[model samples]
Target: MYLLKRRVLQFFTMILLGMLLLVLLYSIDGLIPFLIVIAIAAPLIVGWQILFDQVQPQAKLAWLLAVLFIPFLGALAWVMFGRTPRRHRRVKRTSSEIRMFRQAIEMERIETANAVSDRFPLTRTLQKLGATGADGHTSTKLLVNGEAKFEAVLRDIEQATHHIHVQYYLFRTDDISSKIRDALIKKSNENVTVRFLYDGLGSQEIGEDFIEPLRESRVHVEAFDPVVHPLLVFNANFRNHQKLIVIDGKIAYTGGLNVGDEYLGKEEKLGFWRDTHLRVEGPLVRELQRLFIENWLYAGIEDDKETWDLFANEEHLPEYFIDEPKDSNGATQLLVTSPGKDVTIRDGLMQLMMEAKESIWITTPYLIPPPELLALLEVAGKSGIDVRIVVPGKGDEWFSFHATEYYFEQLLKRNVRIYKYNRHFIHAKTVLIDGKIALVGTANLDFRSMYLNHEMTIAQFETSSVQELHDAFLKDFDESILIDWSILRKKTNGKRFVEAFCHIFSPLL
Candidate 1:
């Protein structure tokens, strides 16, 4: 209903704007020639660009259709959303910083090369896509829900001796967010350096009341691609969806849970938030710290002195770089993906699916998988590998949920099992393969995560974390209702039509 209303409003607004454009053109003398030229040239130029663009076929087709049918508005929309802006300066600076850590990373790679290659075959491919390979001697604890993750994170923040780095897609003004803010303020008073970053669009509701306190305490804060800043205006499609926190360059956390009351199951509309987060210690923490600092730099922090201060000094680099404990057998790699960059997370997921021997189990809130990934899932299921997906029984977004439903028939035909979490919104994004390797991250199994937003995933191989995720999936299965094709066929024709309509917008969704 909400989506329908929004679309109707948009349609009427576009119609009014088009009418006004015509009125203005007619009021001017000899403007018909200019209008004719625009009508002829706009679609052709945009269509040519769409054809040659790097977007997926589905998205390209969607754009082409929009241009052909709704020429003026579609061309304007294309100019705003379709063009992928290059981050050349940000990438160059980030690459240089990453290079400074390579000497230490290369030394460790020499020691763990055999273990990484033998255990995780996808690590090398991920490395080529600009992600660091597996880091051995890392200890991991699977945080089962928002409660556990917050407890661990708060405790870590309190114990921070050096500095605390934090970022979230959504930072709400609620009990949990307040607690975190107060903790960080106390730490800042104790002389701990605190840097906080949040997505401007995702946390747009965070007003001055929530941020003024932090600013007063001297905690460095910035918004990633602020929605209404002079440098950027309403960048709705491209988002920084990374949820990360690193403490003292030793411990780090990342996963599906953002800093919000809804994430804590306090949002009554979506009860019992089922999510997954990972707490890690060892070399992986350094990688996470590197990512956070690089993102901090990209978030408009340009002062060379300020950036160098965050890394401490060259003499103390070994403490942040070479410190290893050999605490667990987990070999973990962090994979990041952004628009105009290789889809590291998607490619890594496909590789894992192809290598699956026994089962491929996935849980995500959104299920609009890319065409290639959808095909891979079908193939894996047809090959007799156990393929199961768990999605939300109650989604917060209307169009995305219906768009997910549209893919059910195709997957059902391939023998893949689908389960809707009946008890709560299952927001965890995970993939467990062969009961050995697992991926836990903020990236959903959808086109946006693959091609539009910035995303990160933790690929763990030969770890107890995989078994923990396997057990969690089993528990989730017990709480979910298995979906069947026969049941889907019983839906009303109106419902089916709505789903089909929603699916048409999946590329944009």
Candidate 2:
């Protein structure tokens, strides 16, 4: 109810603001300038809609129609209400930078070994998925929930010898966050190069004073993209949703864990938070370090040979996956998609799912997938491929939860196994297929993750990791409740209509 009311209020607010802007333009009293501005803005708005519509054509049709019908008013509504948060420039890598990084890594791959063989049947798949010759010798430990993740991070920080690179979507100033900050400061004081990169929008609530103490201790702290004025909040679209930490270019951490009380189970509203974090120790740490370097550079940190050399230790063999559209050396491909990019990770995942052979296992907190994605799963299930999905019975987003449930009904009818996790909000984003391939990253099975946000996923092929992930899925399945199709079909007509309406906006939601 609160969410519905909020949306209603926001709709009116946007309408009022659009009218004011239109009136202001008309009052300019210069027909030529007004016409010029409209001409320029028209194409810009239309092009934006076309691009987004192509990405999710089905769900975006209504919005596209509304914009076309109303023109000025429609464009304003779309801009003010239709657009999702823009991709933050703070985390975006320029085409040149990405190209350079890919070239440099490709050159590095020439010196690496062909770790893929018949014994590792998934090597070709990995190469296709983007793993290729990017191999690293590393140990990976999965951390379940915030407590375990925090403990592991603290251990790495305490053992840091030379440098520590940290990037996170959110870094709060609460107890756990402060403890980590203090540790970083102490490490910096001891001459350990400590670099902290945080998303400006995600950590905006934390004041400069929170980082002041770290700077005082000589710790290098940088916000990914800092908004200088309140009026520019619209520009806060792009964000660094990646959580990464590299210690002395040897150990690293990734996965969904962020630095906040809610993540740590210290928030009153979200208790016993369930999440996943990976502690990786291997040559792959260098690749993780490289990603941090790229993000640091994007955050305006100067990158030099000295900083690059910290990760130049070639003695350790690390399997690194480079995500490029044209690389063809390996079957394992790394798919990274952002709002600005032509190929999105979400779409890539959908494509992969369409090619599934035996089964598709997906786990995510949010299940508001686009219509096409929902249809793909429905088709896959109808075709007799084992299609299974696990979502939180109770989600952090209430509307999203209901929206997910709405899709589950259709899936259930098609024999897709829909599991509602009652333990806690399952925040992991992973998908395993036919016990041969798996996707692990921050990308959720939703429209926002697919199109609006910048997301990265490591597609592993023919690896034991897939089996492990499958086993984990089965374990989770045991703890979940399978939705009854008959019960769902019995829902009231009005309720079904409401869900159908919500599902229509799944792309925008």
| Model 1: ten consecutive residues of lowest lDDT | 1-10
110 Cα displacement, candidate 1 (Å): 9.0
Query: lDDT by residue for model 2 over 163-264, one digit each (tens)?
Result: 888888778889999999998999999999888888766676678789899889877777776756423334443456778888876677877777888887
Report the lDDT tens digits of candidate 1 across residue range 1-509. 11234344455655676687688678976887888688779888988998998888888888999888999778656765566545534566656655654543444331347777777666776677666767777878899998999999999999998788899988989999999999999999898889989987777767888889998998888888776631233355677899999888789899999987888899998989999999988877777877786677677545544453346355655544546665777688888888776688888888889889999999998899888999999999999999999999998888889999888888989999999999869899999999999999999999889888889999888788988998999999999999996789799999999999989878877
- Residue pair clashes in candidate 1: none
lDDT of each: 0.81, 0.67
> What's the lDDT of the predicted structure labeled candidate 2?
0.67
> In candidate 2, which residue ranges exceed 4 Å CA deviation?
1-16, 19-54, 59-62, 65-117, 125-136, 229-231, 301-335, 342-357, 435-437, 460-471
TM-score of 2: 0.79
**Predicted structure with the largest TM-score when compared to the true one:** 1
